[model samples]
Target chain A: MQELVEVRWHGRGGQGAKTAAQFLAEAALDAGKFIQAFPEYGPERAGAPIRTYTRISEKPINLHCGVVNPGYVVVIDPTLLSPAIVEGLSDQGILVVNTNEPIEAVRKKTNFQKGKVGVVDATQISLDTLGRPMPNMPMLGALLKVVPLVKLEDLYKNIKAKFLKKIGEEKTNANIAGIKKAYEQVRVG
Target chain B: MRKVVAMTGDQAAAEAMRQIEPDVVAAYPITPQTEIVMGFAQFVADGRVQTEMIPVESEHSAMSACVGAAASGARTMTATSANGLALMWEIVYIAASTRLPIVMPVVNRALSGPINIHCDHSDTMGARDSGWLQIYCENNQEVYENVIMAIRIAEHKDIRLPVMVCQDGFITSHAVEGIKLYDDKQVKEFIGAYQLEHSLLDIDKPVTYGPLDLQDFYFEHKRQQAEAIKNSLKAIPEIFAEFKKYFGSAYDFIDTYKLDDAELAIVALSSTAGTTKVVIDELRAQGKNVGLLRPRFFRPFPKEKIVRALSGLKAVAILDRSEAFSGQGGALFAEIRSALLDEPKRPLTVNYIYGLGGRDIDLQQIKSVYADLEKIVKAKKVKDLINYLGVR
Candidate 1:
């Protein structure tokens, strides 16, 4: 891992993009890493495009501006994929997408020659396990597969503890299962 | 033991409020600031703290309720942002002049004509002269610490005034970061109990508040208020010393970053200062002698400290998040320039108004400001006294 890891999340409102960023930061924090997570807020309603950022560092992170050249970009909405989504990403960077398409098809759609691409059927995984189309949890699992910023067990523990109360035990268990499945099934190219 | 937790600036302020648990919190929700109130309101609902949460109809009523509560010898607190603060404009001054020790966490946002809700210093800068002590925060930790410290600063026997703990709206307020929170008992013990000598509810020795005194004594009362705020220049350090001893964290009126040997520097406030630090490091690696001076307390102005910090520099740029429209420069530049007037060897200073209406101030922009300062020092003069940075 780099001295500082910056990740950007592109998702529509109500898709839990902001929450996913927060979860990543919180899990990083629990792992004794300094972290920051914030959303680029605007006058946008549900289904509107939104971006959130997460930074994890071994040292204190001081930069307050939005992450432009992120080392990793997570796209939770497959329909929102475009060349703009991969802007500022380096060839060495990683792009994680929540999609049913294979790596070749996803690469053709995004026209992303820079960096590696990881694709997963997050919508199907969430539906099978969570009984819904919320892809944030599975996206996190895919992100960890491509770039393990935090330990997989640590992320699982943090998520279980965070959601077990707000969401019941059954849903939390299903969410954990979805994450584990996505982590195993993510196709990176 | 200090608990390390991940929280946004708003949550940090709310957590501090929960620990302090003032007698009254009268607030109306506003975006960015809405979370602080809502988080505290949750504490109220959960019975985590013994606070009378008043869901006031408007910011006007909010401040009015706070003034009434503070005058009645109750420790009061509140939170608001841009237009909500504008709505509380009338009572904001009254709360100050009445010598009510109210602590408000102001999430700095742009005042609206187009109705924008994002980070800027315009909201608090507009109230700079309202007699309330304003302390700008750099991050979530500073937000948490300043809110906790403001309680003591405001309620101090010598300095009985309101305090605005200002943090950038959505920038720090919405951004989650790791912060160390002290134990609740230690915090409670540090703030101690609110001790009012003479309160409105104290029927034994009643006193008048906000009485009409047109020309007869209004001037004298204003003078007294001025003196009290000035006294904070002395009282604040003492409180800070005690806080440092108790919390093991030292705080000063101004934070200077790598300014000791630097010839060029940027003076800014809040989160921008953090970004400036990153730029300063990058510049320093390139053998450029540049630094940053971030003022935490903008109310008492810390004129002498600011002057001392920039005394030996070749040139300095002052970054203001709000455009003062003074035509000359922004609020910080004007005050800092005035402070440097008496100094014989003050650095050549210019003003850069940046980040208005929540425009992001990137590291590159800050680097350019340093680059401009380098040019100013080389020319030994400033071409433009007031400059707009990052504006199209």
Candidate 2:
């Protein structure tokens, strides 16, 4: 296993992409991995393009800049997809997209030929399970399929513990369902 | 028992505040710094602490309230960033001159004209000589520990000065990372209790604070304050040793990463040092004698130790996150250049001002810095002495 793995996330504001990255880092920490997760801040507004990053390692992750050449690029919004999304992805990297499109089509559309790709119908999954179009939780589920950096069981426990009080059990359970559904339904190539 | 948890720098600092439970927290929300005071405010709301939460109208008012609270002999704290810190500039100096031990977590942000709320040292660097003790951290864990340590450092009788526990805004402030946290009991026991020696509220032994001091005693009072900061050099090691004995993380005024026998080195502060360390490891593997020196204490400057560390090196690059625009170099570059004046084997030194307005400093850029150092070493002379890195 690689000692360090860097992941970049592309999404729009208010989509919880930052939150998903936070959860991923926290879950990796739960698994005893040193992790850093942060979102790029700018004069960005809701539904505008934004970026977030995560770095997980067996040792304390010391690099403090943004993730430029990422081992995994997780796109939380299908509309935000572009060739630039995978511009600096490592050759052995994996790109995960939250789209209903087939894996082959996502690869073709993004022109992400350098790395392995995964696609999930996260929008549909979120609408089905979460009763909304928030793709953040589902995207994390798809990311888990591409890179087992954190355990799903641990993520679930974390989600429950962090959100159970503020968001209540019902909404937390919905997010958990959204995660599981996306995990099972994601197609990797 | 200690708990290991994943959290951001702001959250971690707030957690430390919760443990310390200072008498007052005067705060105004600013980007990047908002999370810290917000988290602390929640603690106040939930009655997790007995802190008097003063939600002031503005940053100036926030600092003013802090000065008032501290003068009344309360263990005082407040947080701000960028313009917020700028707004509190007047009171910031007074808090120090009055010898009030108010602690503040300054989320490092670029001061504005273009109005950016990003990670940079400009905020704290601008206040370097404001009579406050400044400590920078590379990550969330360090920020947490530094805030806890800042309390002791600020309140020390020998070093009764305000302290700024700074971490990179957005980078470390917002970034979630795994950190080991001491138990509440452990933290409480370690910090012990803060007892104010002089209080305006002490009717029987009253003393005036921030009173009108005309030129007659102003210079003398300032000299005394300067002497107090200089004396803090002795107090820091004592508190640092005690902290390590109890908490098990030994910290020093300056942290040297692989600098031993290094021909070239990079000097930086805050999160940039973390990235520079990665570059150092990569170069070390390639048999390059390179290292990094991060100054944990910036106010007292750690002049003697820094001079000793860079004396024998072939070349050194001082990286500054804030621009002095002095046409010479950044503030750090100037200080370091002055410090190395008496060194017999002074390394060829250059300044690289970088990461201003939260610009991303990749590993390649850090490598280029070392490459520049190598060139300087071979040429036996420095060229373009003050340069910019990761900037067009």
What are the chain A TM-scores of the candidates, in order? Answer: 0.97, 0.97
lDDT digits (tens) for residues B1-392 of candidate 2: 66789888999999999999999999999988999999999999999999999999999999999999999989999999999999999999999999999999999999997889888888888999999999999889999999999999999989999999999998899888888999999899988888888888999998888879998999999999999999999899999999999989999999999998898999999899999999999999999999999998988889999999888999999999999989889989999988998899998899999999999998999999999989888889998999989898
Q: What's the distance in Å from true for residue B197, model 2?
A: 1.7
| Model-by-model DockQ, in order | 0.92, 0.90
Model 1 stretches with alpha carbons more than 4 Å out: none
**DockQ of predicted candidate 2:** 0.90
Q: TM-scores across all candidates? A: 0.99, 0.98
Model 2: residues with Cα > 4 Å off, grouped in runs: none
Tell how far residue B276 is off in model 1, in angstroms.
0.6
Best-matching candidate per TM-score: 1
Q: Which numbered prediction scores highest in lDDT against the true structure?
A: 1
Candidate 1 structure quality by residue, lDDT tens digits, A93-153: 8899998888887778878875799999999999999999999999999999888899878
